[model samples]
Every structure is written in structure tokens, then in C-alpha cells.
Target: MSETVSPPDRAHPGLLGQALALRAAWLGMDRAPAAIAFAASVKGIVLLYVAVFLVFCATRPGPGSMLIVALGLAGCAAMPARRTLVIGLTTLLFIMLRPTRSEDLSDFLRRELDLVGSIDQRILIAGAGIAFLAFGMAALRLQSTFRETAPGRHPVLTMMLVFFAILSVALSGLLPVEFAAEVWLFLAALASGFWCIAYALADQKVKQTTDPLPRAAFFRPFWEGPTLPIGKGAGFLAKFEAKDDTALAVTRLKGLKLIVWGALLAGLDAAARSLLHTEAGLPVLTDAMAAAARGTPLPAALSWASLVVHYLLDILHLAAWGHVVVALIRVAGYGIPRNTVRPLAARSLAEFWNRYYFYFKELLVDFFFYPAFLRWFKKYPRLRVAFATFCAACVGNWLFHFMGRIDILAVNGVLPGLRAFESYLFYCVVLAAGLILSQLRKRRPKPEDGFLRYDVLPRLHVGLFFCLLTIFNEPIDAFTIGERFAFLFSLFGA
Candidate 1:
């Protein structure tokens, strides 16, 4: 079961790496401060939780929040502190929120499951308490357990543990067992990570010869690694020549990388989906779409396809129109010696997009089918650009149209959404025409002595054209820069 990874051929890996690296570096600095701050942050978060409960009590005199808070403090405090009053308090909060009927499981759980919601939650909290006890009794247990593991400890293993711990902490809200155990475990892990980072950053010497705790904390290994030092020969991009010296290449790298990664991830997702549908009794996205079309209440898992499609359509439409505004604004302010080289370089309908309206393209290419497209482009440069451009528009248009069409079809019982191909071509043509006109309108080399065209012509031409576009196009109308104000020009159109 080997998974394929298809990153773009022209993709640069520097940007994402840089963002993460920067975060890690900052975290690595002043470990002790981070640890203490993390502990303090947890205490504050707890108090905040308590305050929220207190507020709830003030509003409706509910015991649920109070119970939760007391239970939490008990976990943090001790066995003697874990009084029946706290449990009673939690039960009361659940009772307040509980419905009159005892039939609904959710409701029943809220009310009846007050003491320990589930066996799993109880185990989680009880286990944590045991661990805390062990830590207190045998302070060296952690060091011993970590060292004496039969499987043997390694940086990779340490990292895996750290990753799982971090994930637990990060996804605290989504935890299935909303019990005292999970909350405490999450808080403790947060403290651990925060303190570990703080300790690393503190002005303290390394007492032990070496702590291979990275076997337990993932990112720490990368931090401890000698290779990633700052002012070192470009930690990630050291091998890449483009990153070595070129700025333009570096700029395109992120966009290209995203194009590459997005495509691979999408493919992987598709394949995983196929496998799931085949092996398990799982329905695919298409099934979800069909259900949505039929006005059937789709299962939550199935709804993801429609949601993704909706978001994709909305975002791309916005990006495309936003780029158009950028073009118009650039032209509107052309009198100030601005350049139109980007627009001019786009020779045809397709190139116009690669030159203008580029973010989505970058997004698509970097993330969607970068590897496939890069290879396809390299092999057939002429057809590559044209096909890629057309496909990008078509898919984007199709998704957008499908979303709108689905809305109409589901709600109004309409047949056939907008033709993806027609709108795709229309988008291409309009953008191409705009670019061509811009190129054709590129100013003749101004003589030093000639009347400065910078003053009036562009103001009349570019500004008027922009205003007109805003009035006519629905997309443009959505991005109006300024009010007409009875023929007055607006400061910002979009």
C-alpha cells in the first residue's frame, strides 16, 4: 500500500517550510518562559472556564458549569478535594440544561450521565489521576519509563509521542469524551509543551550530557538537529539553485509548490476515498451530490463534497473578480507612471490568466495537479499552457456554476445548471480581450520634450472604463469602488 506523492516539477518548497520553521524557532527560544507561561495560560483558561460557569449560574442558576469547574479543580487539586458536592454541582448543571423528557439520548446523557458521562471518560480522568499520583510518588518514573521501554526510544518515536500529545492539545474542543479526564490531559499536555519550549529557551546550561526527549517530542528533534541553525546555508533550500540567488523564482516557488502539493493531495484524497468506498460500505462524494440533488438530507460525511464544492466556487469567483479590480485599479492610476507589463505579456486568453488573476491558478497548480501539469506542460509547452488554462477555468467555472445550479435545482426544481464550457470560454475571452487591449494600449516611448500623457488621457480612458465595467458586470458590481454620487468618482470601487 504505497501512496503516490505528485508535487509540481517547478514547485519551490521554501515558503511553507519557512513559515513552520519560523514558528518552531520562536517556540524553541526561551523554553522556561514558555513553560511557565504555558502553565499560567492553562490556569487562566481554567479560571476563564470557571468564570463562564459562574456567569451561567448568574443567568439561570445552572449547576452544570459549576460542576465542570469544580471537577476540573478537583482533578488539578487532589483526591481529598474531589468532594461529592463537585459531582452534585456538575449533575445540577446537566439537570438545568436537561429537557423534560428522558427519551433523547443526548438529553439523557446531559442529565443522567452527569457523574461520569461514559466509561471512556471516567477511565481517561481516572488514569490521569493515577499518573499524577505516580509522578508525585516516583518522580523518576517518566525518565525511567522513557528510558526503559523495551521497544527502545528514538528521536522518531519521541517525536511521534509529542505529535500525538500536541494533536490532543490542539484538538481539545473536538475530543469525543467531554469528560474531566480529557480536559485535564489536554491541559497537562499544553503545560508540558509550553514548559519544554520555555526550558529550552531559558538561560540554563545543558546539565545532562544529552536528552533524546525528541523521541517523546517530535519537533524538538528538528530543533536539536545541527543542520537547521540560522545563518546556516539555507536549511531547506540549500540544495535548490533557484532559491540560492533568484527572487522571482523564489516568489513563484510558493505558488508552484502549492500547485504541486494541492494536486497530489487531491489525488491522494480521491484515491483514499475510492478505497474507502470499495472496501468499507462507504458512499463517495458523487453519492452525496446525488443525495443533495434529490433534496435528501445527506449524512454529515457525505455533505463534505457539496460543502467543498460550494466553498471552492465562492472563493474562485471572488479571486477572479478581485484580480479584475486589481487590473482596473492599476490602469486607473496609470497616470502616476505605473507599469502594465504583466497584462501585456499575456498574449492570448489563457496567458492573460497566468499573467493576471493568478492566485487561484497558483493555488490550483501548486496544490491540485502540479506534478501532472508540470510534466504535461514540459512535454507539450504550447498545448500545456492553453489546456491547463482552459481546464482551470472550466473546472473553476463548473464548480461555481454547479453550486449555483444545485441551489436552483434543489430549491426551485430547475433542470441543467449553467453550461460550464460556455462560461469558461466567456471568462477566458473577456480576460484575454482586456489583456490584449491593455497591450495594444501600451504607451509609445515618451519623448523627453513631448506633452506629458501622464496628466489626462489615462484618467479619461482607464478611469471611465473601470467605472463602466463596475456598472455592467455582476461580479464587478459586487466590487464597486465608490458610489456614483451623481457622476462623482469613488475613492475605492471594490
Candidate 2:
């Protein structure tokens, strides 16, 4: 009987059977925790809101003040804020504007700055150029084509080469002046992001830990956000990438939350603009400046409040967009961190700087601060920190902005651009000084420091400083520094 017994037969499944099995496995996550289920539901709602928000905003007509408002929102979202009320109020305005405006959305959108078309073309071309450069560098290093030509071995040289090539393209006359300036600025923006990779490679080479730049990251800056990138380099971002299915799931869930939050913030931005500027009839900075120039100045209190609203809304917009982009990345399995953190709650200038536009700050730190810190200031720790802070907060910051807006200079003439820079220059100097001092005075708060000293005072100081700084930050290109000062002094009855 034992000899006659036959082994049990097994049958193999076909492709369709395997697919069904996969489907069943994927759908069988019923054991996921209650918290995860709740989170997933919330994320779904958020993403839905985000879609509605973007379509509404982008479909609007013309750039005009809307572009400025968009910029303001971008500033807020890209930076950390302590509160959400302003964000909410601003969002409500946009929600209302979208429906009430009778003009055909497509008509307005089609006429958007012709500059936008050129900008897009330039961005793509520049991106392709950078890709070529990156691959060429990678090839040289990988193939040992030239031992001395490796990017890691000659990081500074590699950067310099790219810089000159970009400069040549910008000045090549192959493109129109406006397009050329945009190309230059686009490259500058990308440079701020790419410098981190160069710095990483350089530092690693110094320590014999060099690795090739990830090819996938070469064009990241082009699509990450509109103007400023939230993350710097592939190497840095690689650290945050999800390593497992669980981590990937968590990151995607987080992305959904950000998208929802950003959509809500967009609503707040629209509301703020409606309440403060549209309905209340507060003149925009440009109008206010014009009025002031004509000797019919805005009321001091209103001027101050207007600036605050403008800056707050701008920040909200940036934050909103940043969340959308970052969430998309996270959902794609790259768990890059948020670009901003509680910026409004920052206890110090340095803290605010670090929290706001985090990756931009990182770019400055990687390329400007660290180099100065490590190489030149070893003997004077305080001076070292101050110097490094200046290099980043002032020099790098100013250069980036100036380059980004170089088109303004070219279009309006260099003298006008320089004049416009006066207010910005003053703002940068003050910002640099404050940040430098903050850096030098940085310390861990002791328990004895108390909530008032450690928690309340520092935050208040940061808030006040940023608020005052916003005055200079407003569209002050048309006005002299003297005019801006007079306007500020008028506000305080000085």
C-alpha cells in the first residue's frame, strides 16, 4: 500500500493567476493600524482640495498683482510659520475670486507674460546643457579618461567650468536679451542648488570618500519648484529616500497630508488678499510707493499692516506650492524633508533662516558658510561664525536674488535695477548683521532660562525683526532707500 501511494500533485499558476494573487496581496492590508487608516482618509481629502486649488489659481487671468500674490504665497509656504489663521483667511479670498470673476479663464491664462514661454524654453535648454556637463564629468571620473579631470578630484574647477559655459550661453546673442537674462538667472538659480553637490563631492574627495553624482538628480531643480529649489543635491536627498515598503507608505501618506494642508493654505492666501487689499482697498506696495512719491502717502498704520499682510500671504503661497512639490516627491518614494519648519516660531535670526527656505539656507551653508568656517576662521571662533554667516546670509543671498531678477535690470536698464537694489541691499546688510549676531550668540537654553526668556522673548524678537525687514522687502525698486526710510519713520512717528 505504501509503495502504491503517489506523491500529491501540484499545479502552477499562469500570468493571470499571478496578477490576481498580486492584486489580492496588495488589497489585503486590512490589518493596518487604525491610525494609518485615519491618516489615509485625511490624505485623500487633502489631495482632492489641492487639485481644486491649483486648477482655480492657475486658470486665472494675467500675471499682474496675481503674480505678486502668488509670489507672496510661495514665500509663506516655502518658509515655516508659527500660526495658521493668516493662511486660512488668505485661502478664502482665492476660493471666492475664482468663481466671481466673469472673464474666461483660458483667455487670461493664454496672455500670461510672453516671458513665461521664453523662460520655459530657456529652462529646458539649460537643463539639457547641465545634463550634458554632468554626464561628461561622470564619464571622465568613471572611465579614468583623465585622472586630473574627475569632478570629485577638481570640484571647484568643475564648477568654474560650468559657470563659464553658462555665462557664455547667456552672453552668446543666440537668444534675445530678455531670454538671455532669463537663461543667466535660470542657471544662477540652478547653481545655488547644484553647488551643494559640488561641495559634497569636494568634501568627500578631501576625505577620500568621493562618490559620483546621481544621474537622476541632474534635472531635479528644473521641476522641483518654480524659482527656488527646496532640496539641494542628490547626495543630500538620497539620505531621506524611503528604504522599505513601510517607509515608502509612510512617506506617501505624509505627502498627502502636506498637499491637503497646502490647499487649505492657498485658500487662506486668497482670503487675505481679498480682505486686506481688494475689499479693504489697501494699496499694494507699488501703489503705496507711487502715492508716497506723489506726496499722498498711505497712513502709517495701514502701510505697516499692508506690508505684513503682503509678506504673510507671499509666504503662505510659497509654502503651499512647496508642500505640493515635496508631497509629490515623497509619494514617488523619495522621502525628502519639508522645505520649511516653524519659521514664525523661530527663537533667533539664525533659527528663522534655517527654518525658512531650508534648502536655500542649506545651499548657502554648504557652499559659502562651511568653506569660510573650515578654512579661514579656525583661530577666531566668534569671528569665524560671523564671517561664515555673512558669506551665506549676505553674499550668497544677495547674489542669488540679484541673478534671479537680473532680467528686471536688463529690461528696465541697469541703473534702474541698481537703484531698485538699494532697498534690497540695505535689507540684506541688516539681515546679515542680525543673523551673524544670532550665530555668534547661539547657545543651548538651560532650564533656568525659563519659558519667558527662552521661548517667548526669542520668538517675539524674530517676529518683530522679520516684520520690520518686510518693509524693505516690499516692491521698493521704484523708491530710493531714503524714501523707504522716510516711509518707515513715518510709520513709527520718528
Candidate 3:
């Protein structure tokens, strides 16, 4: 017998039908030729700007110094012919305006370099910008020229070795204080733009790569995102650039949608913060940790509540910021993926890591995992996978966080700074083990396993694993590894 299909309204009644209808309307506008044309028109651009401004005001108390630059880049990006030149020039301008991401670097320069009156800070920063650009250009040239050479074949590894060599020398104190300070400043610039340069160099090996200027431009791009290279290098963006007006319009509409969604997430984050920390009178995680360190801990129930709430809020905060950055890139006509996806929905630890911070995970996989996998343990499949996981999740993860705290290494002695990373080091090791097991497991939950087994149990296990791992994910110099263990035990009244 033939079965009869329900009408759309009958299938999804009331509010559900209305939601589906709205989504269908959006999809229709997203594809219709006339709608696309209108979206790419001047009036559409103006509307986008107005909407962005309103969202900015609603989300951010201050729109930040790079807002104007970001908006200008978005406008210029709409004109495909001038996009490359505009991006290159604006990136140079941004570097001149703000040379380094870390404010602590400025303080380090003043105190360690003794540049308080010897030279203007602006001049020094400008000099750093010039050095960075020149170095980036030379690196690109080296990669292109020496593609067959060992250094060119593995630029990321070479760069890391060189960076650490210089860092070691600067910290060795063998050179005069003044000269060492100059070296430290150069190191700061290199560290800030390290991954960008790596991505650019990596792109050079590709058959069709961007020009050196545009490639270098992505080193601290006009969007002023975190040092993680959110959209990656020029080659990655080139693949996603809109080819026609219709595509551009669709991309821009998606961008606007992302911005609005990001703004909503931001608002939700703020509301959650206020509700948990203010309304409910729960202490911040850091404050709670500090209290625990001081031999006074909150009740175990409260501690667990704080931990769970903090984890959710942290995901929301990262997603909000990442969405804004990706949206701006999309507006500029490059349809890159969002930096954070549905991490909470992830059913496995490895999957959670992939969803939680995509760009960072990609960075590790590209720079560390691929290299090790291709080179070592080729005859042993499990060993290869485990080794690659170790390289990426443990070694690369630790190095990335350690590089981010370079200013701390400069301020405190190298030994002290290394000690500060002890807790994070433990975190990385355990994370690698968990990820390795997750990847190696032969069987996975399936539909036949039932809802509780297939859906609920795996997610709950993943959540608890990550939540407990948070104890060791302390900031630089926040707590000792032993103290973090103590706090972890306290959660169970041990």
C-alpha cells in the first residue's frame, strides 16, 4: 500500500512551521537573482554598515581601534580588482598603528630595553613593523627559491627552531643588555606574527600561491584577530573568494547573518555572566580557585556548579568572538568556516577538541601532526596515529601556549617561566592521551545503541572529561601543578 505524505503545515505545526517558513524565506532570498543583485548593491552595503554598527553598540561598549580599518577593508573587498592592494596596504597601516598584540611587550621594552628616553616608542614600533615586513618578505622568497631544500620543505619546523635559538640567546645574557633588548624586541614581533608567516611559507609550496605582498599582508591581517591566523594565509582565502556578484551577495548575506548571530551570542554571554555571577551570587572560577588555594573552598556543590557554568560561558565567549572575526572575513568576500562550531554537541574528546577551537586544532594538525605522521612510524598504523596525536595534541599544544607567554619568559627568568607552564604541560599530556584513545577505539556508538547509550552517555562522558581537565588549564603563573591537583581532589571532597 502507498503511504500518504502530510502537508508542510501538518508536518510542522504552529511555531515550528513558522520557523521553517522563515528559514525558507531566507534561503529563497539567499539564492534569488534579483535578491542577490540587491544584496550586492550600494544600498545593501549601507544597510550592512548600519546593521554592523548597531550590533557593535549592542555587544561592545567600545567598538575598538580596528573597527574603522575592518569596515574599510570590507568595503574595499567588495571591489575584487583592488582587494589585494587594499589588504596589503591596510595591513601595513595596522602594523604601524599597533605593532604587537601584547601590551606587556611594551612594558618589557621600557623596563628591560631602557628605551624610556633614548628613542620614541612610536619610532621603535615602526622599526619593528619594517623589520617584520622585511623578514616576512625574505622568508617568502626563501620558500619560493628553495622549495626543494630541507628548510623550504618544512618551514614551520625550521621557523620554530630558529625562533627558539634566538630566544635562548637573548635569555642567556651573554650579549650587552642594550643589544639583547633589541633582539628581544625583534623576537616579540616574530612571535606575534609567527603562525602567519608559517602559513604564508607553507602556501609557497602549493602550485598556485599568492604574491609575496598579499601573503605577508595576512600576517596580522586587517581584521586584527588573535595571533592564531583565523582565516589562515592568502592561499586559503583565495580559494574562498567570491567569483561573481551572485556569490558575493550570498557571502555578504551570510556574513550579516553571522554578525547578527554573533551579537546575539554575545548578549547571551553577558546575560549568563550576570545571572550566574551577580544574580545567583556564584563566584568566578578564578576567584573560587584562589579561595581554594588559600585553604578555604566553596562547598563541593557550588564548586561543581561554578565549573560547569564557567565551561559553558567560556564556549559561548569564544564562539561569539570567533563568529565576529569569521563574519568580517566573509563580508570581505572570503567564505571561510567559523572558528568555533557546536563544541557542546561533540560526543567524543577528539571531536570536542576539533569543534572547540578549530583554527588552533588545524594549526597543530598542519604544523605538527601531518609532519610527524608522514615521516615516522610509517610501517605501524596505530603507532603512526598515536605518535601524530602526541606531536599535535601534546607538543604543538604546549608550544603554542608557551609562545603566547613569551612576554612572561622575558619578564621572569627562563627557568621561572618554564615552571609557570607546569600545570598546562600536565593538561596537554592528558589531553593527548585522551585524544589518542578516542581515535584508536574501533567501535563507536551507533543508532542501534539506543538514545541513552548512543546520545546521552557519550556526551556526558566527554563533558565530564573536559570539565575536569579545566583544573589543569590554568593561566601562566596562576597555580602550581600540585595545587591544581589539590583543587581537583577537593571537587570530590577528597
Candidate 4:
């Protein structure tokens, strides 16, 4: 049977309905007296809190103590070109700021600038130029070869091109040994940003609904953090961009609310850390290990409590930071979602993974999980699912972290760095196994199961599992696998 297709004008009538609803809401916000009163009261309260927090918490008071102002200025400077120029500048910044023993930025730059002006820099620049040309040429060929068929395009070609660039930079010998590592680090930072370019290439090749972002909007958001792309692609980001005056106003308001909420969480994290570490005298993992080695071990309960506090504080810190970053982006007219959510309430390993470090999970799932899932294990559904889960949860997770910390690889060499990652390696393996089991055992809840059995118990179980694994999650160099295991055992009177 031939299905009747709707006309393009009526194809997405729902979008029009949504637009009308939004206009109505905006008009209502202005007209509603009760809403106006409530908004005014909330705004006044938030302003008061902001003032108090700024006075006590935000300002540190002293020379060179206005770090917050410096950060605000940096963000402001980048805000103008939140699309591409910022990425270029930031990448250049990373390249120039090679690791140095020099005590000050001025001294370090003076030393590094010589290397920057050397043949190594030229080689690096030349390599980038050639790579860009190659990508452009390849893209053109793909377009011609595929004959406008989008299905033939793949992200792997772009990824392989990036890998080649990294390898060329690292082994080109056009750079000093120390400088080559830094260059590799810079490339790694820019690697994930390639998603934008890849998506753009695919769109151009296939002629998708997603119009490729102009070249200017391509690279900016990728290197904003440690290789974990904050907002995915320009297409995903388009949904959040403020379309009109009302949207801009709403987005800015949302940004303001986030700033306030982030401030509260930050305050809470600070208080909790002070109470746990300063008042209670409980140490972090590294310090605890040192204490144990000295035979001055803390009580098991106190130690466990400190670890729990550390984990919770870490989550709070990420949430606060994510909220602040999302707020800033929204205020600048691009709406990005929060990176962290209510992870503590997650009912399973899979749920926790999704809630915590959402963008990282998204990156792995998009790039690794789906690809592996579709390509392999078609004959065995369960194995395919589990294997694909492992690819994302373990393999992709490790690669992201390892490359993100390329400085360690530079200083210690590849072997030593891998050695130092033993605990992390174990953690990833165990985590993947747990997540796979959790996925396989997942079931729908019955009303008769009650809240305790269905909700509270499951949440507690997942929380306990993650909390236990937190010991091995730290950089293994900071605390060895044996030390982490011993500490874990000590928590249970071993």
C-alpha cells in the first residue's frame, strides 16, 4: 500500500503549535499579576543571596586574589566568539603553554616562545595546514564519489585523518621531545571537536535537513574543557539557541536562575568539605594512604564517611560548575544542557552513568556504543548488547581520560603512564561488568513491589556500588592499586 505523504508546509504542524504556545506563555508572563509578584519576590531574594555570597565567598581579598575577576574576564573575552575564534585561541594557548619548570607565566612564555618560533612550530603549523587541505580535498572527493548520497559518508574517515595528524605531530621529529608531547596534547584536546566538522561533512555529503554550520562556528566549544565536548554538535545545539526576543529573555532568565542555583551548590560543597576534612580531620585518599603507611590509620567508619563525603562533594562540584557553564552559554544565546543531574537518585549502574558526566557518556555512546552495537554480534543479541556496553563504558572511557591527561604520558613515558593507570584500568573493567549485569537484569517495576523494593532499595544498592568503587577511581599514580584495595578492605575491618 502506498502511503500518502503530507505537504512540506503541514509536515511539522506540531512545531507551529509549540510556537503559538510559547507566544501565549510569554504574553501571560507579562499580564499575570500573581506571577509578576512572585517573580519580583524571588528576584529580590536571589539578589540578596548573591550580594552576601559575593562579599563572603566570591572575593578572597588580597593582591592577585581577584582570581574570580580574571576568570570572568576570560569568559567575557571568549564570549564574543563562542563559536570558532575561541577554539583557535584556546588551542594556541595550550600549544604555547608547554610544561615548564619556570615559576612564573612571564618566564615560562619567554622560554617557550623560543621553541614556538622554532622549526618545530613551523612543522606543527605546516602539518595542520596540510591536514586541513587533505580533509577539504577528501570531503570534495567524497561528495563527488558518493554522488550526493549521504549514506556513504562516515565519521571514521575524519577520525582517521585526525589520528594521522596526531601521529605526524608526535613522531615528526620536527619538534623537540618535550614540545612534541605538548603538541600531541593540543591535538587530543581538538580531537573531539572534530565531531562538528564530521557532522558538517556528512550533512554536506548527504544533503540532510541540518544545514552545515558555517566554517566559523565549527571548533569553538570542543576544547572548552578536557576533551569532553560540552555541547555536542551545532545541530544539537540549535534547539537551545534563542530564536527570538522572547526566547532570548527566557534564556537569560534561565541563566540567572542557574547562576543562583550553582552558587548555592558551590556554597554547600565548600561547607561540606570544610566539615569533613578540616573539622572532622578525615583525609582524602592520598593523605589517608600516607597515614595508613605511617600506622596512624583513621577509624574505618570515619574513613568511609570521608570517602562518601568526597564523592558527594565531587558530584556537587561538577553540578555547580556545569550549571554555571550552561548558564553562561545560555546568556550568550546558545542553550546547552546541564552536564550533571540528580545522580545520587539513580537506580542502577546504567542510570548513574547517564546522570553523572552526561556529556562524556553521550560522547562514548554516540561515537563508540552505537557503532559497535550495529556492526557486531548480530547473531547473539545479548552478547552484542554487553560487548557494545563495554566498548563505551570501558574502552572509550579509558581512551578519553588517557588522552585528556596526555601530560602524564609526556613526563613519564607511555609505559609508566599505563602502569600508573592500573587502578583506573581495573575500575573501568569492573564498572563495565557491573553496568552490563545491571542492563541484563533490568526489569519493569510492578505497583505491588512498593516504593522500598522498587525505588529506595535499588537507589541505595547502586549508590553503594559506586561509592565502593570510588576508591579506585582516583589517578592510580596518586594511590596504587594495592593501596586502594587495602583502603577498601580497611573500610570493612580487614
Tens digits of per-residue lDDT for model 3, 77-118: 456557777777767876765566655655565565463347
Q: Superposing every Cα of model 1 onto the true structure, what RMSD results?
A: 25.4
Error of 4 at 494 (Å): 1.7
Taking the tens digit of each residue's C-alpha lDDT, what string does model 1 give over 1-494?
Answer: 99999976885559988899876654443233443243235463344334433432332323533354445334322321222233233323332232111122223223323444555644443344334223322322233344445322232224335544644453344444445324434333222222222222110112221332321221111111111111111111112212111221222222222223333344445555556566664554344434443445365534543334333333333333332222221111111111112433332333434543343444334322343456566776645555554444444333332322222221222222132223333444454345344534445324353344543454344433433332222231122122222111211211
Candidate 1 stretches greater than 4 Å from native: 1-361, 367-372, 375-380, 414-416, 419-425, 432-494
Winner by lDDT between candidate 4 and candidate 2: 4
Q: Please give each candidate's TM-score.
A: 0.23, 0.66, 0.91, 0.70
Worst-scoring 10-residue span by lDDT in model 1: 330-339
Ranked by lDDT, the better of candidates 2 and 3 is 3
Better of 3 and 4 by lDDT: 3
Superposed Cα deviation of residue 350, candidate 2 (Å): 1.5
lDDT of model 1 at position 309 = 38
Q: Give the top-scoring candidate (TM-score).
A: 3
Alpha carbon lDDT of residue 277, candidate 1? Answer: 61
Each model's lDDT comes to: 0.33, 0.57, 0.81, 0.60
Ranking by TM-score: 3, 4, 2, 1
